[model samples]
Target chain A: DAGITQSPRHKVTETGTPVTLRCHQTENHRYMYWYRQDPGHGLRLIHYSYGVKDTDKGEVSDGYSVSRSKTEDFLLTLESATSSQTSVYFCAISAVSGSYEQYFGPGTRLTVT
Target chain B: DQQVKQNSPSLSVQEGRISILNCDYTNSMFDYFLWYKKYPAEGPTFLISISSIKDKNEDGRFTVFLNKSAKHLSLHIVPSQPGDSAVYFCAASAGDKVIFGPGTSLSVIP
Candidate 1:
């Protein structure tokens, strides 16, 4: 119910290609995060941004990159997509860095063949 | 290693009955704990949360019980409904970072 939105809700692409996912929020929250959901593994954080131009890696940041150029947008990029990168990606926004709640976007499903 | 663990992979409860989901954590220094519910094909939504200083917190039909001494927590849904059927994930946070458990699928038989 948060104003978070993710672009390219569904996509099928070939391996070794560059892919970027976008997260936009209307709430103007300070924290935005990217996570990939997989079976049995739950959801793993790939990267997060605390503020515009400020970003950090997460537990499963390997082979993934992210950038936040504006307060409303956070982008997750796969330098070169791999089959292993195929998963449902979610974007989240929190009002503060240490807040207990974070609102999530619908999600983006990407498949790498 | 997983900092948070949801031992049960799935659970079933009859409609209008109580549904109890359990979670255990390895780290004693976690500052906060949270529960999230996810429907198929959708991102997770925050259901409830409790701080380390609190033992219990409640909202509507949902309540979270935290036992710091045992490094455990539990979520209880009273009079469970079909809409409550979803995958539940328990997460722990230390400062600004948080870690998630594998998730437990809950089915409410209506």
Candidate 2:
């Protein structure tokens, strides 16, 4: 129930197309993260941002990019969408960098045909 | 390689019975552990967490037991209810990075 929301809850796009998912938070937390949920694989971190304009890649950052222009918004972009990139994407916010609990947004489901 | 592992894919418990979910980690440097619950069509939510320094931490009906020597942890839910039926994911953190297990689905039969 944290003040977080993801735009385009559901979408379908063709392969090799550009796609961007947005995450917006109202809690003003300093840390924001993007994760993809897949069957049997659980959740894998794609990218994260510590502060405005500060970002870092995660365990599964391949073929994905993220940016945080403002404290309230974080964006995940796929330069060229692929079938492998189709999954439920979640955005999370945390107050601290490490050893801190995170609040998650509803999620965005994207499909690449 | 998976740093965190949940051996069981699914479990069933009768209402009012105890439900136990287990987790194991390979990293010895992990200093923090957490449990997250996810409902269908929704993102996961933090349920409870415990630091490596402690063996056990309890909050109401939920209790997390950590065995650093065995590199294992378990979450117990007493008097399980239907609302507690969901996929439970165990996570371990080493500094800024956290690894999550595949998740165990729990079905509380009424």
Candidate 3:
């Protein structure tokens, strides 16, 4: 397994509350990504960071925000949670030159009530 | 518009049989493709991948074939086992950013 860990393996929160999920990697890879997995929808990219302070929005960036202040940690925040945001979130990392064989974390299951 | 699409929602195969999963993409510029497998309650794990420069790439019981002209790719798993049951996703990358398909649930019955 890659040295990637997603904190709070499971979380349950009420709607309209703020939520923050953390992803930590020990590999020092240059690319880190946050993705959400829903039934029948597979995994959709929410946001990603190429380096500290350098990030970009993915296809499903709405209602989500991310920050990478250091090489080892990338954080995703939902300002106001909604039932629609309930999904399994995963963090992935890849080397800058490899075939982009992303290594994924165990995932965080977030449920919004 | 979805750049990568896996039309099949689920597929079932008997143990020891061959399993084939299909994926399609509309982007011509995507030069790299990959497959990831995910078990229930777990994150996806890298399975196999092929570069657009080549037609096929194989690893052990897993093989990936890419058809550039047709803009499609497929994954073949021989002698499929019950342990192989999981959801598989197809992904395409232009650079460091990758787009993924909806995914296909594969069930291998013993």
> What are the per-residue Cα lDDT tens digits for candidate 2 across B21-102?
9999999999999999999999899999999999999999999999999999999999899999999999998877678899
Query: Highest DockQ among the candidates is held by which one?
Result: 2
Ranking by TM-score: 2, 1, 3
DockQ scores of the candidates = 0.70, 0.76, 0.62
Candidate 1 DockQ score?
A: 0.70
Model 1 clashing residue pairs (backbone): none
TM-score-wise, the better of 1 and 3 is 1
Give the DockQ ranking, best first: 2, 1, 3
Better by DockQ, candidate 2 or 1: 2
Candidate 2 wrong stretches, greater than 4 Å: none
Cα lDDT for residue A59, candidate 3: 84
TM-scores for all predictions: 0.98, 0.98, 0.97
lDDT of 1 by residue, A11-109 (tens): 999999999999999998999999999989888888988899999889999999999989999999999999999999999999976347888899999
Q: Write the per-residue lDDT of candidate 1 for residues B1-110, one digit (tens) a residue.
A: 88889999999999999999999999988989999999998889999999999999999999999999999999999989999999999999886677889999999999
